[model samples]
Target: MSAAQIATGEIAVGQLDLEYVVAARLTLVAHAHARGARLTVNGHVAVNDAAIRVGRVHGITRDRRGFHVHAVAMINVIEMAPERAVLDAGNTILGNTIQSNGQSGVAVCCAGVTNNLVRQNSISGNGAAGIDLVGSNGVYGVTANDPCDTDTGGNDLQNFPVLNYAFDVGGGVIVNGSLNSHANTSYRLEFFASDVCSGSGYGQGKTFLGSANVTTDGSCNANFQTLLNSPVASGQFVTATATDPNNNTSEFSACAPVIAFRLLSIKRQENDVHLMWTTLAGKTNIVQRAFSPGGSFADIGPMIILGGTGQITATYIDIGGATATNYYYRMRLGP
Candidate 1:
């Protein structure tokens, strides 16, 4: 637990004890680091109300008590009673999901990250906005992007919306947005839900630049259902949902099969990494590029349509360019 100089690092709960869970109660943090530092919270930690605060430079340059100058919210949270998981920001973050932390899921009071990607995370049920993204005069602004919705989670009787920020650009990638904010730059949201009223299902939504899009690829009647149906004075909200054609049915076959991923095999082959997996179904299956070694979850190059579903395989070439650090990558499955 020391802060010297972070080049490339990995911190996981699976590697550490449950001490962070206890530290979360006091004013102390579970863990925090900076300077090109890389962190991974792989579905293992149980640190509720875990606040992650990065150093900021406000006051100087009108950064507001040095709180503005710069702040990154790759998956940082703010706006909770005890400020559970209060975070500053990371240089380039990937593979992070924030859920029901204190009040605001991922409270981003005033933050943003350039050249970074946020994927498959839930920013839900805080007192305010699920994933708060805003910047003041002295604070840096957040330029967002949407990966586009791949799943319309309502077709199956088992799928329903849980924590979402999906918007009108595609279908359920961005959710619960503000009209009077952030120069109208579209943000992408990858959301999921536990199960439908009957079975278990999870769906994702997306929103890009100007337009909003939502899709419910699951079978839950009320899953992926927008609490605030309309955008908050934003230009327009476009939604596409798939439900049972009849009043009561469990035919997910007719239902749009959503793009869901389960890590199967991750291997390093020569200079490149070979990523293989299977999908329930996909409409637009794309491969994204990101930084780090054999590691990219962010969208870099133009998306490549890999075509249809079920046990698909794709390879990303490093071409020896990715040497010094870790590169990450993930498949973008949608319908």
Candidate 2:
């Protein structure tokens, strides 16, 4: 059945004993289903592009295998018991846009619901989480329900974390991005740096800079800040990935080029001047000096290589400069 806007008090689309069915592009508003009357099925079934709102009970529930919900919009619902989008394990919920629901946007509320892949969907503005794995005494715990759980070897989730560097006082690199998944859950963010940018081989020799755990805000947004050990040069590539608490990690985001440094400090020493900086690994820095501040600076030393799996602090020393003449120094990354 397809392409119908259902406005009745209750409508049953599929039977419990039916097999091989498809329901698509149906819109239901402020509706309900009779008790025990749901879109039940036994074999393969698909529900796509359906808009369901203000559902008094379960909306498009399933109890059997081969059920899939894609591109469906479910909003302002009270509950998604037995699973809002799927019940049986291995079912798929892909590209469905859900928001502002009274309960969870996607849920696994019953036993035997495992290995469901919930991917690439916009879920937010809900009363509860964008996704939920509710466990009860009637069933086993909600383990391995989210396909993004790496411990169970589920499907890989994909996320991109944005990085911003601040060079001012008390500054650090700020990483911020949004992931489309269950809200209020902690995910690990792994940062990597590469010497090259924009190629399949670019990140091949990438170095792991650091990692931090961040819990998604109510809106599924993640933000973190950390000081780097070395100075990241401009044009170097950087990328990040998200790993759920279960240790399942999403694919790395598209590599972005490093544009600036988080911190650079210059200090005058008794005989030699000291230059210190902090940045990610895998970046190369060139230090230069001039007789006067803002004058033409020439390369004074060899390129400094930052090597490690985390933030790095690098220092350079300039010796035998006329203390009374006032020498100037600056650092820049190699191309």
Candidate 3:
């Protein structure tokens, strides 16, 4: 359908497959005037046209929710700025290919744009971020990860996952990272692979690898170790996003290359236990000690907090284990 408006009660809840070319805009007018509208735009193809847009521009009071744009191809938008291949909010944009557009491939604008889940999409070669969040002040760009995630803007300025290491493990890729945000919260992390990291070092989610769910600790910290079934080649980079329980998606995290797995070394220094390890630079490492081989390990501190720049050897001295006859020491990566 080139230009169609979904009015109230015309189509309550279903899928709208647009195989034909869309010369104009297919707007969901149901949300602009009414509320409780649920629809999905599936398998649509739009080229050299205005493409699809959801929700109205300047009416936040109107309730527009539950729209899904899935498995669609939107490319080469002929429209000028302020019009993109897909402009939406309070919806889900998943598994679509949106590229070479006038503005961002998909943009969520205005003040009240929230709970819009934009993930697992091949969005690149666009004017702005693969998914750009335009704020109430009319500012549109990539927002950096804030400490504690206290700030709020587009998508509540959700904090993206900081990837520490991603290594190709023959059949799959092992990704390790952490998210520091609201305490005692659950987040859905999505991983992606790309040939090159974006210039901003944020994201350009090219290939969706997989996803994992994690909940942060009381300290607003959550560590994750996910094995993506996708086989990423050496030198390729992996990026990820964090979506809170609120369904607000963040910008892409900094890319981490898929390299070899990290190695660790352990030794006994008289009565002290000496441990050393090395991994990707900028990784946070902690030393954990266990009484028995299979016992629960607890973090040992006072001299073992490690984080650095170059690929240097990280050492931890554990004198507390001197008295223990049987002590197992190992280093853990990430928070």
After TM-score superposition, what is the CA distance of residue 79 in candidate 3 from its true location, in Å? Answer: 12
Candidate 2 to native Cα RMSD, angstroms: 14.4
lDDT of 2 by residue, 142-174 (tens): 232232232221223234344543221132233
**What is the Å distance of residue 143 in model 1 from its true position?**
13
| Colliding residue pairs in candidate 2 | 150-248, 229-311, 229-312, 229-313, 230-278, 230-279, 230-312, 231-278, 231-279
Q: After superposition, how far is residue 163 of candidate 3 from its true place, in Å?
A: 1.3
lDDT of 3: 0.64
Best by lDDT: 3
Considering lDDT, where higher is better, how would the candidates rank from best to worst?
Answer: 3, 2, 1
TM-score of 3: 0.59
- Give the 10-residue window scoring lowest on summed lDDT in candidate 1: 247-256
Candidates 2 and 3, the one with greater lDDT: 3
For candidate 3, what is the total of clashing residue pairs? 0
Cα lDDT of model 1 by residue, 75-179, tens digit? 332222223232243322222344433433332233232222233333333332333333343222211221222211111111111222332222332333221
> Any runs in candidate 3 off by more than 4 Å, and if so which?
1-86, 262-335
**Whole-model Cα lDDT of every candidate shown, in order:** 0.30, 0.46, 0.64
Q: Give the Å shift of residue 252 in candidate 2.
A: 17
TM-score of 1: 0.25
